[model samples]
Target: MATGRPYQLVVFGASGFTGQFVVEEVARVAAEDELRGSLQWAVAGRSREKLQAVLEKAAKKLGKSELKSEVNIILCDVSDPSSLADMAKQTALVLNCVGPYRFFGEPVVKACVENGTSCIDISGEPQFLEGMYLNYNDKAAEKGAYIIGSCGFDSIPADMGVLYTRSNLKGTLTAVESFLNIKSGSEGSCIHDGTWKSAVYGLADQDNLRKLRRQIGHKPLPVIGRKLKGRGAVFYSNELNQYSVPFMGSDVSVVKRTQRYLHTHLNESPIQYAAYTTVGGIGSVIKLMFAGLLFLMLVKFDFGRKLLIKYPEFFSGGHFTKEGPTEKQMEESSFEMTFFGEGYSTGQDPQQGKPNVKICTQVKGPEAGYVATPIAMVQAAVTLLKDKSSLPKQGGVYSPGAAFSETKLIDRLNKHGIEFSVISKPEA
Candidate 1:
């Protein structure tokens, strides 16, 4: 399908904060591919001057002085529809790093869908993902162009990791609970400013989110089967030996969609899923609860959100800022997520209070926003390019698991420093 394209991939929004990291990672990968002559890609943004500067800086950061010389820079803007359409016509795939995706993402996707260019983005915004499906799924399917969202740290690890865990089990996967633990290895690592701005707006726009979900309608449940649902409540988990709270992001939403897809379309057994962020102790859990309450109360008003954005550090958790982690910090930083599964095998007894079987699976990677995101984002694009047969036949807005197959992505991530492992399994 991509046979005639001059460029295999295009990194749009390459001048932004996360975009810079993506450019550098692309450059690094490009260097390794010079011999094979297979890494044909370009960087694009609204301003040629800014794009040039970012490319130069990325070249210096990678210690490859000629990296910029080998890379291409194109000018494209979301506000300029013709330029976006031109961009879509030029590449087989577009990796969009532009975020707070509620505003700018749709038009670019529109351009790509019409032009039949495959698109992937590091968007964690649930509203954007759902709205795309509601508005553009049919168009993308008609054009044979796949559009995948939340491919980065937001939900890929959680979504794909769940499927990876399922592979190791023999019985039906009735339930899975994932717990997240992250630690910055050094001073330079941090949450990006884009994530901060997006979180603020995403929380504030609850009405639109509900409307979009309504537009998509719910996936039907299987007949005569155990139902799948997201876990409720914040509580202590005996499995991890820590207090946990519902993860305040799009992960649950993405994983839930994936499970629904598997059940309704693929006819796979349903899975009950839940995701959480761990607290060191009960005191931290109380603080988190109050913080969430304060956040909910603030998002109800425009002025309150502005105040929160103006002073992000007021809350106890580390604040998001424009500065990202240093290269050393990026490489050193890591994220670890442990998934716990408890359910009986197929045809096993179901009357007990809790199933006897227990399993633990883990997914780990480096520098969530800065490091792992770019890796996952780029890998998703490349996988879509090289492994077309592994994808769903029809193109639509899809979760990572639904769009890309598990073994292919897991192998890709493993080669790039992310690891998915079965930490423990029930005995024979």
Candidate 2:
């Protein structure tokens, strides 16, 4: 269906905060491929003026003045089905950046599936993602459209990070526990209110998500070894010498979805997984506890959720803002996720006692929300474009690990700045 498409990719929502960075990342890749000149992409949204401004800003920042005139603009809105269908028809794939996806994502997914154009989004909302799969997977598969979510910092680093760890291990990798450490260079870090809004709504709809899971009716994968133990809400991590808490993102859900897909379709052994993020100190932990308690209390009602959305900075301790972080702050921030895996050595029996082998791997990159996200998303798009044959035989909704596990996605990410490597040799 993608043969001789006018454009290979289209950046939908190109005028949004994160969308602009995606445009810049695509421009960077375009500049690097100046000699080949095969990367054809455009910016898309409801406002041509905003899209043009995005291009101009990216051009000025990248020192590529041609970008303003070179990249095309397509006017489309999630509310208008015809416009979305038109936009989907013009491209082989769409990189969706418009988020709080629970509200705006499905229309684009429907359009892409109807048009047989694959789509990917950096959504961290599990309800939206799982809902899309439950509703559209069969239709998308029939139409040859791949709809994958959480391609950004939310889960890619964790999902694909697990894949990297398993592949590097010398034996059957049974369990993986990932610890995320985010560092701010003197400038400090902040996230946009869009992420905050998404979280607010995702939490408020937890009951619906639970109901949707029952509708999906997927059977559980068999346990291969000792089940990974869950940690307390707050705990101390000797691994990084920092106070830690279970990561409140979509990583665990996304990774489990990928593991389920692999185990069911490919008959692969499933790896137990747990995810955590480091909190700075005892003071930070106390603050986090207070904020978390308040957040949970507020997310249960309409008025409370509204308040949470209206004053994101106040609630998040200035970690999230409507204006977002400055370029300097983004440049100064970075993240690393370390994966520690335990499994049995080769030729070991499945029912054996005390699995002996252990290995460690890490994925590190620039500022998680804005910087590394665009890089991972654009690289995933490029990989989908260049390695179609390596993807699933038929397109459908999938997680990042399920969709790009067989492709050179990790290698492409490495060349583009997100590094994945083994940090320690296997030990018995």
Candidate 3:
């Protein structure tokens, strides 16, 4: 499908904390035998000095002489559309690591969509992404650009995991429940200016709930309409035996989209799904109490808002170090997810099957953000660049499993140190 010379893959926000990691990933992939000539990539950010410093460090760390020589830098500001448009020019793909995307990402995505440059971001913010879906999906579809978000650790693995399990199911899948278990080496901190920006935007906006509703209105069904149906004001499931919180973002959107894409594009089985953070025992009680207090405080008192601002560190990005789980530790770290599904088939007598799949993947590392994110981001980009024909033509936004095949993505991920496998399955 690509008729031009080698595509230019640009990493925007290349000097930021995660941006540097992405650059290293780009270099690592470039050193690989298969993907060597498929991309002409560079890192772009506002500060040339910071960008150069990162490039120098990356060259040293990667032990690649040609890295410094071959990589180029482009100066683009998220606030400036003309600058973004210029940055988008001649580039077939843009990997955006500049976040919290609600504030700074729109211009970059707008530029990419208008220019027909495929774009991906490591945004975990659901409201912002939902806004994009509502506002730009049509334009992006028209332009033939794939403007995907949450390409990072927040949702990709879990989203893809569910997709893989669903593909293995026999009959129509009525529902899916996913659980994520993360064991990390450190209590993560978010210190970057981008994190601060996202915090400020989230704090300043009182209408996020309303915005979320509007955004959901534009998203595909099973995603937009599915609510956790139960009797109590809050219900607990004994399977996980935890109080669930609304997974506040694109995780639900991405998962639902994956299911929708499979049904529409691949003719796979249709299913309903929900994602939630698992909190158990005393932790659940604490969270529930905290939630109640916060709800009452926000609804009843300006003093509560003031109290929250006073503890901005709790809310802002500076609380966590860029230090991530080491490779050896990540190797020891493990991840698990369980899917609950029910199937019914029309027969002489109706049959009911309660089939559940549980999968656990372990790799060498700490928190997923540091190592896993870079691998996933770069591999997704590589998958996009190398396997263009397999992707959908109208690429406004897509999940990993929906956008690319599980085998292709899993192979690419395995090359970058993350080993994944399904642990259990529903009986045929």
Candidate 4:
């Protein structure tokens, strides 16, 4: 129950497929004691009709038909700047799900920062994320409003998983080789169009991503220790005994930002980060290589890019089309991320050729795009509201680890299905 404001949280894309989960999550949490006095929230989108339908269905989904009355609906379109400003002024927090963030993400962020309202999104777009930092980070800091991107599965597990490993390490953290594994329990599997479209758009615009990085001014590396190594964007890891390749997503950028933030601002040592996914057996590796090559061409060539835009479903193996994933598909899928790390002993003096320690950790969660995203976003929103004191006093654009503590989010994600646990530790 928010006092001065009518709502504690407002979901801006409540009618979209991912937005429904966010709406439902807010409703479900409202039924519990999480709502301080009364559940005060609103679902927003361009269309009132769709928002109404989602609000009504969300009540049923929560198993509390009467909860519909407690929930409210508001309409705002990303296309209109004033409308976004108005919405930003009403709520203390906004969970934005509408994306290919590079296209539709900035205005809402601008509104929130200007209004001094904190914002969170499940964005995996590097260009958009880096742009926010370059354009809005200072203004948001002036306003004391934190704009945290990649709150969802895209980088949460990656960023937080590294934090978990480092926290448990008795050594100076040096390197993290992260791996992504996906599994589904239902009859069929699809990555959902929202996630797919984000990937394709990001692929086609790699140069912009690099340009943004330079504009953002790459953070200085440690002066006297092992600097991060970029052996290749994609490579195989012998430690994991699996053919690993670059994640080809925002996970790497997000993870690195978190590390950079810590190094620059918190005086923590910078640690190198590498991200990958398992390709299963030999046959699947060949298929993955073909798919990888196809994706490279799609992004590198205008002709191939046009085909992707026109017939995404055909290229996406029917996983992405005009419609998004069904509730069943979202429900039946899950993902896991494992971290293999090496570093020097924490108490020992820095040395060049000696990374004598190793540690293992993993984060387990439900379907990344759907099931886990809502929980991650809501938890972040609630934590910002509840734990504002412990957070960075001067707000700015930040990665998850830099903005919030491992304990604050790790505890919340653990309560849900997204959990972080240490798998192994170096000897004493």
lDDT of candidate model 4 versus the reference: 0.80
Residue 294 in candidate 4, Cα distance off native in Å: 2.3
Summarize candidate 1's per-residue lDDT along 64-95 as a digit string, tens digits: 88766878888998899999999999898899
Model 3, range 257-319, lDDT digits (tens) per residue? 677777777776556666655445676557566755564455345665554445544432233
RMSD of 4: 2.3
Error of 2 at 81 (Å): 0.4
Which portions of model 4 show Cα errors greater than 4 Å? Answer: 1-3, 223-241
Worst 10 residues of 1 by lDDT: 221-230
Q: Residue 267 error for model 2, in Å? A: 1.1
Q: Candidate 3: which stretches are off by over 4 Å?
A: 1-7, 186-246, 264-269, 280-335, 344-366, 405-407
Local distance difference test scores for all models: 0.81, 0.92, 0.66, 0.80
Give the per-residue lDDT digits (tens) of candidate 4, residues 1-428: 12277777899988887888888887776666766456577888999889888878876676778756766767799999999988988888888988878889999999999898888999988888989999998999988888999998877888888988888898788888888987766656676667777787787777888887778778566543455465453456666666666787788888888888888778888778878887566776777677677877776777887777677777766757667667787778888899988888867665576677889999988888777888888888878877777788788999898888533888878987788998888678
lDDT of 3 at 427: 50
- When sorted by lDDT, best at the front, the candidate numbers are 2, 1, 4, 3
Best by TM-score: 2
Q: Alpha-carbon error at 40 in model 1, in Å?
A: 1.2
TM-score of each: 0.93, 0.98, 0.80, 0.93
Candidate 2 residue-wise lDDT, 359-384, digit = tens: 98999999999999999999889888
